[model samples]
Target: MPLALYLLALAVFAMGTSEFMLAGLLPDLAADLGVTVGAAGTLTSAFAVGMAVGAPLMAALARAWPRRATLLGFTLTFAAAHAVGAVTASFPVLFATRIVAALANAGFLAVALTAAAALVPADRKGRALAVLLSGTTLATVAGVPGGSVLGTLLGWRAAFWAVAVLCLPAALGILTGVPADRGRRETSGGPALRVEFAQLTGVPLLRAMLLGALVNAATFAGFTFLAPVVTGPAGLGEWWVPVALVLFGAGSFAGVTVAGRLADRRPGSVLAVGGPLLLLGWPALALLAERPAVLLALVFVQGALSFALGATLITRVLYEAAAAPTLAGAYATAALNTGAATGPLIAAAALTTAAGVLGPLWTSGLLVAAALLTALPARAATTPGRNPEAAR
Candidate 1:
């Protein structure tokens, strides 16, 4: 692995922190902005909406630019978005800033994944992606909870300020670390965006996209409301919210580590087994939410399963569309964000009924189970000699 990979991960750390920190700061943000909590919640969806649209749009716009320049530009834009967000007292301005930050975040992630895979051997792409994604898992573990504490003490704006400042070091790393020549090289003469997207409609690629969305949908449905889950149902104190989040983050980090090592050799099996395992944790948590120990245990397990298949899914899609790794990477980001945006709505709908906040857990579990079953038919397309990208 190269030092540049870590630089990519560092950028992702800043992006991931901003992306998820809002979940922990919801109450403070709502009160400070003088809006309903529901309106505050929309900020998360707003960010996701930006990512969903921005991934492909950025990929297309920067398709001709050097990877290093694109990455540096995106990181700077992200830092500026946070700076503006930190100063703005108005809710609308803050919301718009989130969209801007997410657009840059999406572009950075899509380019980083493509750049990462290009730097490594085909066989090691999965592990490379794991290294990149570990930044996000680490963010969930440290950044989100730390932001919550910071919000409690200094105000939520402080967290944004921190994220903004972190980008300076990350930008420097990208400037000095990644080789100029390496960044400029993508698969030369690859198909155009339209052609690449058309090719992406193959069965295996579609399945990978659907699976990514469903997995995130299942994961976020409960995660978006984790603080309440811990304090209300698990009977934990306010302080314990960070502890539980740490536990979940720890599980997610471990899951990514293990899955990275296995993805290249057994991606299909990873998805098949891990998806259902993920589903089980949800029902267990839903049934045992009132039991502190059980709820804690289930949260760890659920978080592990939630992220375990990530590298595998990305690897599968890249394999299916190898010639257009950047476009495929953009699509993967969009798919996950699409799910992130939709999952809360599903959770909200479930909460309106007798199911309550815990309803999301059960609803998410069913969605994961169905998603896994839906992916079964795509197995044949993943076999070694039948690669869609190769055939094309």
Candidate 2:
């Protein structure tokens, strides 16, 4: 991997921190904004919706621009959005900033994946994407826990300021680290938006994307409510929330690391094992969440399995859409965010019911099972000329 790829990972780390810090800050945010915790959670959905809507549109509009410039522009915009978020007192204003930040976040991720994929051989796109996404996993390990501590010690706004400070260096990294032509590809005569949409909407790609969405939804459903789950049934206090988050993040990092090595070699096999394991892990989490001794252990397992499946999903999508890898990568980003947006809503609704804290476990489990079914046909789709027929 080139230095530029790692720099792209750094950019992802900053964005990922911004994206996930809200999870740990939800209680503080709800209290500060005078909103219900469920309502406060909508801020997360807002960000995901923005990413789902903005990534492809931004990618299309900026397709003609140089990759390095596009990445730099988005990173600066993201940093500015965080600054706006840090100062906002009104809930609506804060919500708006999340949308703005997510837009930039989506664009940066889509372009970063394209750049990373372009830098490597076709055979290594899986590893390339995994390495790029490792930054996201690392953010969970470092950024989320760090943000939790910052939020606990200072305030929720301080976490935003911290993310803002982190972004400046990420922006500088992209501007100075990535070469002008580093993995740059000509986009002058690329497929138009409608054409790209038609290509991406193919059955194979759609199934792969749906699988991505479902699996991501499952991960977020559990993760979105994790703070409360730990404090309530898991028998941990507020101080231990960061510790739980750290354990989850550590597992995610390890999962992605191992998946990266295996994804390029046998993506189908990775998915075969990873997806089902995620399904199994959730029930285990649901069962163990009330037992403090075992709950943390299950959280780590679920976290690792969720991310491992994610790496395989990305690899499968890229393989299925080799004809238009850039757009495919962008669409994949959109798909994942679509799930990220929906998962919290589902988990929030579950919280309202008698299922309480454990509801997300069941919700996530069903989604993971659905994801597995959707993913099953993807291997056949990877074969040239078989995608359309195999999906049937």
Index of the highest-lDDT prediction? 2
| TM-score against native, each model | 0.94, 0.95
Worst 10 residues of 2 by lDDT: 383-392
Model 1 vs. true fold: TM:
0.94
Which digits, one per residue and each the tens of the lDDT, describe model 2 over residues 163-250?
Answer: 9899889889888999996545566556556677777767878877788888888988888889998899888898888888888888
Cα lDDT for residue 319, candidate 1: 73
Backbone clash numbers for all candidates listed: 0, 0
Residue pairs in candidate 2 whose N, alpha carbon or C atoms collide under 3 angstroms: none
Task: Show model 1 residue runs off by greater than 4 Å.
Answer: 185-188, 381-392
**lDDT of each residue in 302-348, candidate 1, tens digit only:** 88888886557766766766756558678888878888887767776
lDDT for 66 (candidate 2): 83
Against the true structure, candidate 2 has what lDDT? 0.83
